[model samples]
Target: MRTPNASRAALTLAALFLATLSLAALPAGVQARSSDRGKPMLINADDADHALDESQPTVLSGNVVITQGTLDIRSARADVTTRNNEPTRVVLTGSPARLKQEMDDGSPFSANASRIVYDLTSDTVTLTGNVTVNQRGNTMNGPRVVYNMKTGRVQASGTGTGSGNGRVSMRIEPKNPTPADESGND
Candidate 1:
């Protein structure tokens, strides 16, 4: 009971629907952070609040957690900024935002601070306000600490009190310890 033109119209609609589905299935966001490129980032939170405009930042609150590759971040609240639909920066705040990841050498790295800023463009993470970082057996504590992911470099600074009142503190364990010979041979 259908004309040839009607059949053609139905076929066209079906093809259009399938094409739309395929496009919707494509992943959102461009590759902004090279280190995290090709790695899927997952975010979990009690609530996600964001602006209607996709270009604006998204805010996650209440037991927020973000994971990408080996990098893990947890905080009470976090704000994520994206450009071109890719996350460019993330700011986390809490009693103390916590971060953990594995170094290139398989050593464990961890940090905590009142505020943490992760810059995807420069591949750096800055921890501020009572910051502490522990990597392998080395530890650093200060008011501010900056870690460069690409260079494996860390910088910590205090208020320059110079009296250890708020100075940077560090503890580095020896790579190896040798025991003294019991024989006392010459």
Candidate 2:
């Protein structure tokens, strides 16, 4: 038996959990390059298997490299899913898969992990298993990291356990101050 207020509170909590799970926004002033979304994606690999059915995943292996505009990804193997012959998602695996891209402010963003999932529909990249992310001279290390390419929001988490390296860490560099005499009026 639950009171009406209790039920409402439960619903609100559930909604907040769902929101946090789906879209964790990063700090302001850190966004990926918007123009990269409009660019064509190009993939290169030593071997590929394309299924007859367009919905089936296409597998690429051996030194797989994928690029779109300033965004670049490198992995030993990749599984690409398509909708209407356009890639909807890509899962990359390697000893440690790598990704790099230029941010809107011209700073470089990079990540490395054992597995990486790039979801085109959501415009998000999820890195798992000993993940490391670097952006704007700051670094984050954790068991999992999710980056929203569109919003440039990043969410990182640990293993959620008390034992053995179940923690997340970050090193944030201090921002440099602008000089007052840069106007050059003198």
Candidate 3:
């Protein structure tokens, strides 16, 4: 025998899951609006490899692409490390990486960098070495960027590249600056 409240809760949960699946099937822009409910998936090419350490078993080299909601990350070489079959970390390197995600307001963001590191347990991702992110026509040029997968939080910092004078540039779309504005002419 089930109480009325308990039965109602079960039905609500079921409805939520079904709705999630339905939304995930939509295009990327649609997914952005309903991104609160979606699953992260990974795809790997034949060249990808995984190594748990030198002495342990290792998968050879290949292309690996990881997708989460509206976010997509592609890399040439990837190594997946796991303990007890639970993925602890993933490293993507060699061919560099491109990360694309749709912003909440329907704008798109793209990040290009040398390497991308993801920690499953911590839900954190770090992009290193000449990392540049372009979003909503604004560009963030930094050596590194750390983003929390679950919380949508990002921190940008230099990867030991010191000049103290970091550069940040933002550009609004449909509007183009004149030659003098670009060249800093008098």
Which numbered prediction scores highest in lDDT against the true structure? 2
* Ranking according to TM-score, highest score first: 2, 1, 3
lDDT of 1 by residue, 69-104 (tens): 666767898776766555667677988987666544
Task: Report RMSD for candidate 3.
Answer: 11.7
lDDT of 1: 0.60
- Candidate 2, residue 173: lDDT: 69
In model 1, which regions exceed 4 Å deviation? 1-41, 68-71, 102-106, 121-123, 148-153, 160-165, 180-186
Give the root-mean-square deviation of each candidate in angstroms. 15.3, 13.5, 11.7
Cα distance off (Å), candidate 2, residue 78: 1.2
Please identify model 2 stretches exceeding 4 Å from their true place.
1-30, 33-41, 83-88, 119-124, 147-155, 160-165, 177-186
Q: What is the lDDT of candidate 2?
A: 0.65
User: What digit string (tens of lDDT, one per residue) describes model 2 on residues 35-154?
Assistant: 875776566678877775665677778997767687777789877676765566767799898777777888777777888777778877777888777776678888887777678577
State the C-alpha lDDT per candidate.
0.60, 0.65, 0.52
Question: For candidate 3, what is the TM-score?
Answer: 0.53
Candidate 2: clashing pairs of residues: 26-153
Error of 2 at 50 (Å): 0.5
Q: Each model's TM-score?
A: 0.62, 0.64, 0.53
Model 3 segments more than 4 A misplaced: 1-42, 48-60, 66-71, 103-106, 148-153, 159-186
Give the per-residue Cα lDDT of candidate 2 at 77.
87
